[model samples]
Target: MIRLVLLLLLAAGPALADRPRDPGGSVALRVLEIAALEARGEEKRVAGDCLSACTMYLGLSTACFEPDAVLGFHGPRLAWGLPMTPATFEAVTRTMAAYYPPRIARRFLDDWRHTPRFARVEASRLIARGEARACD
Candidate 1:
């Protein structure tokens, strides 16, 4: 009986170990969580809308997008949900630039700076720009 119990426990170990944890909201926290997932050799597939901080996942080499995937990029603000100040926006832009490739980072910094809303990026454009590949 003890051996059977141990066998069951061992059988369940891989599934439990592969379970994904919630990626938190903050940029700092999500970055760490993404790093952990990357270390574990996990793939991040963006099928639907990936907005705001979620766009950070585009930085990961293992991340792929579905044909209909949409990514929304905007300047980051305070956790209190207040409007973004110049300093805060600059800081967020710098952080994002560090993560994203040069062309993608330039688009966010130059094109979307004064958009006043989330800048939507479709999978086709991302692929065309060499930012992401279509998911299998």
Candidate 2:
């Protein structure tokens, strides 16, 4: 009986967790703050791409480009000449494209060559704060 009850509760847990979600409001703010603080400590500890991606997926555009946020999106490995797991590159890009309009998303995805230094800072910041763009 206990095992059955535990299974039932576990199944219900996901449903409860998914409903009335913030869409990353509180999470994004927290991440932004952390990133800023980290940048202060370390000269190059920023990850704006992660933050941007996370925000896009969450569908919280109210503060997408707010003054506090440093806009930066992650691009494919081909641009950086690094090995990116296909899954991650695809997942991140797809997430960005999913949330942002095609024009903006495309700009972010394909424009890594012009990725600003500040964007890296923002991405680092996003990663430090335990926030991520929702991929679902």
Candidate 3:
């Protein structure tokens, strides 16, 4: 019975793995996309630079990073792409808090408050801080 169950699980793995890749998009759009992917049991593997809105994928249930992966974070801005106003900053903080682990979300919000430039977080640091697992 155990072997039969194992075989069944193995056979089901491919179908889960066959989910389509997420086409990259804006921060808000990507959040929806990642949620869909999570619903399908898909995991995100960060192999390269994941900047700005791309860093939002870190919130996924199973997000892993290659050794060289880098993530960039900054405050959200207006539609015209100017710096965020206080309200926009609060909104962005709320969005991130909803998505990321509390510690990471707080750190990110603090960083956003401190700097207007993109803050780079390395994969090693993320792994060390338990924000992301190292990809196999």
lDDT of 1 by residue, 12-61 (tens): 99976664322225777768967997899899887667776777887887
Number of the predicted model whose TM-score against the real structure is largest: 1
lDDT digits (tens) for residues 35-110 of candidate 2: 6645555232222233443445323433322222344444433444667687876665565566555545565666
Backbone clashes, candidate 1: 0
TM-score of 1: 0.72
**Backbone steric clashes in candidate 2, count:** 11
TM-score of 3: 0.70
lDDT by residue (40-71, candidate 3, tens digit) is 98887886667666777778877788867777
Query: Better model by lDDT, 1 or 3?
Result: 1
Write the candidate numbers in order of decreasing TM-score.
1, 3, 2
lDDT of 3 at 63: 79
The regions of model 3 sitting more than 4 angstroms off are 1-25, 82-85
lDDT of 3 at 122: 79
Between prediction 1 and prediction 2, which has the larger TM-score?
Answer: 1
